[model samples]
Target: MKSRKAFGKLLQKYLEGKCSESERQLVEQWYELIDEAPRQDYTEKEWEALEYKLWRKIESESFETADESIESSKLGFWRTYRTGIAASVALLIGAGVWWYLGNQDTNPATIATQPTQSEIAIQDNTSSKPIKIDLEDGSTVTLSPHSQLQYPNHFAANKREVQLRGEALFEVSKDPEKPFYVITNEVVTKVLGTSFYVRSVDATKKIEVEVITGKVSVYEKEKVNNENPGVVLTPNHKVTFFTVEKHFITGLVEKPLPQIKSISKKPETFEFDDAPIGEVLNKLERVYGIDIELENDKLSTCPLTADITQQPLYTKLDIICATINGKYEVKGTTILISGKGCE
Candidate 1:
């Protein structure tokens, strides 16, 4: 192994994007060594100091050590300053452990959390159609190809938690006391009972959850310590967590259907005769549990006379907009309506 002083210098240069190819290779190898080595502990103060030093080095873009004598004997420099490098090694090992653990396996279903010995791991590597998995609590999961699910054979008394990788459509049974949790690489999706589609795309470094029914709460794993309530999504709403960026973007699904069918009473046939546009939109929003934003207040004067309760949401919007000589656009889960006012 290279002396800690030399390795640190190399790493600093690499972080500053100034290292030679050979130096970069050496730094990578050293990182591998640190990860494989057993962890060493440091006092809080020592760890803080080490982090401060690392940040200082990284931020000093034009740094160049003036110790030419130390560079000459790079391999043996640590022997002469054995005590100095030893102290640094302790911090390096700890930091290495942190980085390795954070990145080990991003597939939350299989790699994020360790389950008790009693839990079961279900995996599907075949490229065929989706696999249907029935949970103990009468819920069902349709797992896509190359996906894996880690769940208890029988949910514990407290909660029903499951981990997932790749894509899956979940149909959770209603249990107010025991919330159903789906842990993906980017976010933890929780719900009392609902159907949703979760997709973790490694290529895009994103995790997406689109709700088909009920409501869901999504929050970052890192934010669990804080009091952040995160975001709650109702039916037809969706959230995308960018793993690389560590942020979320909320939006609507491609086609939203009425979510109250199974839970609420049968909806009245969507029939309207000279109905105010605002009233018509209110009904559609209620049926889909989505937000409808009227961009033009003038649209209120445009009464709609159409029956579209049975049609798809987009189709319904198209017909209504056509009748009023207006247009509707979906922006981030909300429908925006604009048009020329009726005389």
Candidate 2:
């Protein structure tokens, strides 16, 4: 039998392909020793080469003197080389472990997808612990303090859908047609290209859907005995889905304001007759109070509508009053809306 030191040298030689057939067989069992992975999947040939290279390096160390054992070697060059090799080994091991886990046979459903392919995270995260998700799609998702969202490996592949938990929002992409749909535990919101929110996790709760553009469809959950559910919604409007006590809730989403659409409707519908001009200002106060600054007459009869959320409040209000053939005069704690029947 060869001494342990000799055995190591011989194995190294085999890995370098410098060993005879008999010697090669002796280390054949170690052919799969370990591999280095730079990606989700590596070829067998490459794995073999990596293993061989590693073995050759490890076997090259001399056992004659602890001095030559790299670690104890007093020589700076040898010590550095040893440290570098040890670090490389650690890195390779980590990479191998990652690849192996990603290809775990136990998770056949998750295995089909390569790590390179990004995965969408869809979960309802509301009034509970924050969900931690590692996606295949190279995207990382951190749900809000109380919200839920559902995503699939592929959006709209068959049923572009997602499920919401509580009051979570989405930073969705601008897909052309294959719209993204989010279903709350009790509600569903659909979007082709936009950001929005959903809040309908608990049965005794209400869900809200607010769009930042594009379009959205909010539907109430339906309850049927083994049959798929149904939905009714109000397009181009932010809505609140309320709960019903009859086993489940079923109703169309309704909005307090008129509808608005980019492609379908270049115009918005809503008229503020002699309705409290103060109420109109209050609407702005409610919609963008935090973002807008209102003082003096700007607070009285300050009418607004039709995409005024993005522009400056003054510009927005100016347009609003102009649209209604009215004007305003700014005062200390109030704004006077005049020029029309806005008395």
Candidate 3:
């Protein structure tokens, strides 16, 4: 390691874009060393004092006595470099203080928290078909073509985090104590043992998260500490984060599927004879884990006789609405039915 004063001068020259190629590389290496160092909690004043003490210690350890004539020559060199050396020391200290403070002052809720010391493994899918990457924690990631995923070899005790670029489907394992976090450039999706699809390819485009099972929490990375921590989406629901607009839009997925837990327990017989519309809607809600609301309370009393087990959810809704002379519209994750009750 170079002496503090010498390193500071080189760093200052690099900042001003005056360093040669070799000097530039050397400064970058130093920066990487600083970045890889373990973080510590230190106030600005304390950091300054530490920096001073650290440099003094380094100087003392590396110090060497010189002959009187050599010392006189070195003193002459210092006289010429004094001003530049002072500015360099100040610049380096300022940068160190800024980095220490910035790292310590982050939101606890931020999904892109500091990574663990464990080695990270990256999976890049270059093939046309999606590739499945199994994690050590029993979770799996289906990385789409041209996409990449960076995950640790072993999850930390407190949380599981992964970085995604492009599109991927995450089937997280159940660990209530250690929630899973998927971080994209624009948004973060947090979950506890859920299956969800995330698409965040281009920064200029939109980032989307659609839940297949369980629940997911999606939020802007910059607004983690805000009163509104983004959108919480349940099964069949999705949230889209528009990068340019910096906002989220929540809605239902295009082709919503019945929740696995609900369907696996028992087979659903969508055959109903003279069943109340409310009862029918209630069954649909439970099956798909979606919300269905009626505009008129009386609409729920309308009788419906239909065999909808063979039809898709929307088609079944269409038949039910047509039978009662009603219409349905999707508002966010909920389906709304409006009609003047059956006469």
Candidate 4:
């Protein structure tokens, strides 16, 4: 019996297109056997009934296998477990079983040399709508209208890289060794794990990156060869690069808000029940990485009770303000709240 580690290694290599013909066949045989396992004990009569059904279906086929009896048995086995096997295969691939389980000693240079064969592309045509692309590494990109994204079918062992044109939002999966890179015409954004937005508009001939959560590093690709390290951005900060000036300007994103999927904390639900407005704003600042200022200090004493969960940052603000007889405004990405004092 092949050890579990060895079997996982073999499966990984096959998925990476690095296995020899014999190794590929061996993996396929193992997969067949795994798929053929029966879920329930069957009597002879039950087996006969299954065989009869399979044969009835096969009678209409024009092609016949030379090993008729053996092929029929394989067909019967497949019919019993095909759905379960398909789901298991999808789960394994999504979980990066190969990368996680395989020996990690492969030379990075050699892995880089592996030719990329498959590329996947996604696009959005309307500015009013956006689309999301799930990458093999468990990261996701939300492409804005009039945008195009191209990525490889399988990531290189040493890095996860993709190309973007136009605008998009990225929620990257964390992998310390295999850094993620988003390359565009004007700038390249790199990070281990974070969420951010990138917009490269041709009319303006500039590229913009807004850090929504975590940290990101953005550099002009042309300047990197000259040893320019570029700028590192923390949450709520943004960097814009002008093609004409060949320079960058750092600022903040409009309407910065918390990224729900990334944060893992207890009582973290956006739900509020007569929570102190000050406490609510603090949590918002922490989650969204944006600063909030209470123009009227007395607003701090006010309490808000609402289930603003799942609402957009602005919507939640709207609800809170409406309840408190207050108002909020965006001033260069900072939320300033002003309201009548609550007695």
Candidate 5:
């Protein structure tokens, strides 16, 4: 604890510009010592990871500090990392110019080739956003607006892997021997060629995966078994996994929002003892062609047994607004909901 306190104080000085030159030298030396400390005190593995994290931070800051260089913005922040102490500070430059093709974003049409796992060259990212992809394996996917799809120039015989940040629908190319997998935020989506959607942009929750076809399994990486980290999701299932909260839940089936809304079909009534807030809002947006908002997260998960009417959009909105004792406002192209935690 004493060493930790001392270390913490030293870091504070370094950040605050309060460390004397001599003290600074001592602090740097101490940092090196701390970096290689034993696992009981400070694991070497963790130290290596910490070094990487610090370097990444440095690279990001360095790039961000170059706001004066407008064109350099196109130059991605890919400063080569010091792989080992003896390794030179290797620097590789990716090409410049960000190209937006309709809905796909291709960065650097003629960038210098590097040894990458896979490269996704975005096309254009304007309209017809969110390109949907269905692999040969019956897996379905909806690529988020302004996103790119990159796979191993070709997949290996044993794995179907992809990385995502924006959003996507994935109906995997099913191969039981080579399970389809996705790597995101220290968690993995493993499937035997099933269909699912992943939204990996929630800063708090950050990632939401919904199963639209077959069963998919999700769990944290390198965690203890006692943690009981995740659950298998089925069709019409959704889960919002929060790293901070350390929990993922199976949500209630949601009706289509106007985003997925179709006409003529009356709203099919349903009851949710513990439905997710996302599906409820989406369904209202789709079915009745109106927006349903929850003012409080506390009410977002509150169970409701309302008999929703699939009447006309306005009629359904009126019934919902009255049922929840709330108000709705329309702005430009989006609708907003206010008040009511649900009864």
Candidate 6:
């Protein structure tokens, strides 16, 4: 028999990973007993007798000097309605058991159960084209063929969360107070209002998130916290999380588009005639919202004359590099250009 305060201290120690081997085993045994109690059937008389024995055990335990009298009074209340309290405890055990073990350090080999009972699951098994789903929060999801999505009928007050399997394109409605979250097996993507694509069907357990508009934050599901905020992606950028290695790699998307829809009302003109290289690159940066760096300051003085309005971003870069005898390479999410300065 242990006092309530002693049991609370032991549970706190277990949560903090500071319990000794024996103490850890004791807490786990308690968890197992509570987990299995809901399945057992006992008559009302048996239940009352059992609760009487348990209460007597608890009341017999001696408390510390400060809590001795207060704990005695509390035990007296439990003693009065011990039978009814026992039934209530049995009803709540299954629902509340997760609170004890959910925060424990998880082993990589362990598989977590999907907790989406309250959500509506939709699997695109027969659809030839992507299925569009409109959420209650005004967000939209384009579920790809053979993909699956689980979402609540109504979003929670503080946040909007949905689960995804396979692939989908999300167009989240703008709600700064209520951020949106897309949860998968490996990674979690968060945004206020943005359009992004998430793919998690890779055979190698790779999770990919590509941003088409606004901004997104991507992080591992198990390692989520304020200190480790994970990677932040903007328009035209993408991040890949390798599940096996637990690593993140960021880069530009294959075909970067102008950030016109979100940033600018009118499309930018990409036709330049004898414009300074710096000015041309600056214009490109503004239109695309991607950083471009020049290795040499003298390259800014070089003149460029080209009409790259019809070309893709990479093609535009190719033409620019060829004209100035330079080469460009992508590092993370930025494009770096290096070449000899004009005479």
Strongest candidate by TM-score: 3
Off by over 4 Å in 3: 1-118, 225-228, 260-264, 340-343
Better of 2 and 6 by lDDT: 6
Give the winner by lDDT: 1 or 3: 3
Worst 10 residues of 5 by lDDT: 89-98
RMSD to the true structure for each prediction, in A, is 13.4, 17.1, 10.6, 16.3, 17.2, 12.9
Which residue pairs collide, candidate 6? none
Q: In model 1, which regions exceed 4 Å deviation? A: 1-113, 125-127, 261-264
- Which parts of model 6 have CA positions greater than 4 angstroms off? 1-119, 261-264, 341-343
lDDT per residue for candidate 4 within 69-114, as digits (tens), equals 6677776675445534334443433333333242244333322332
Which consecutive 10 residues in model 6 have the weakest lDDT in total?
Answer: 94-103
Residue range with the least summed lDDT across 10 consecutive positions in model 2: 108-117
Task: For candidate 6, write residues 87-205 as lDDT tens digits.
Answer: 33333332222222322333233223333333433344347789899998888899998777767776767888777878999999999999998887768899999999999875868
Question: TM-scores, in order shown?
Answer: 0.65, 0.34, 0.66, 0.49, 0.41, 0.65
Model 2: per-residue lDDT, tens digit, 1-343?
2232344455446546798888665455333233332332334345446646765655553233564534653655654555455445434433343233222232323112222212433343444565554333333345765554445565434334454455554655655555555655455465655655555546556666765444665554433222443332322235566665323232222222223433555533234555444565655545432122333454454444455544554565676677556775543223445544332
lDDT of 2: 0.46
lDDT of 5 by residue, 206-324 (tens): 57777766778887644413356367776555777776777776563343233232355643554444555446666765543333555555545544445554454445445545545
Residue-wise lDDT of candidate 1 within 1-343, one digit each (tens)?
Answer: 3343354455556767799998776555433423332223333344455556544543342243545455546634533344343445445534343322323344435323444423544445466789899999999999998776767787878689887878999999999999898877657888999999999878889999999888889888656444675778888889999998898999989888786653447764678999998888887887788888788877876888887877988899888788667788878877898877676
Clashes of 5: 29
Task: List where candidate 5 sits over 4 angstroms from the true fold.
Answer: 1-128, 133-140, 146-150, 224-229, 256-343
Task: Write one digit per residue (lDDT tens) for candidate 3, span 85-151.
Answer: 4345445554443332323334457544454322556566779999999999999999999887878
> 1 or 5, which is superior by TM-score?
1
Answer with 4 or 6, whichever has the higher TM-score. 6
Best by lDDT: 3
Q: Judging by lDDT, tell me the better candidate of 3 and 6.
A: 3
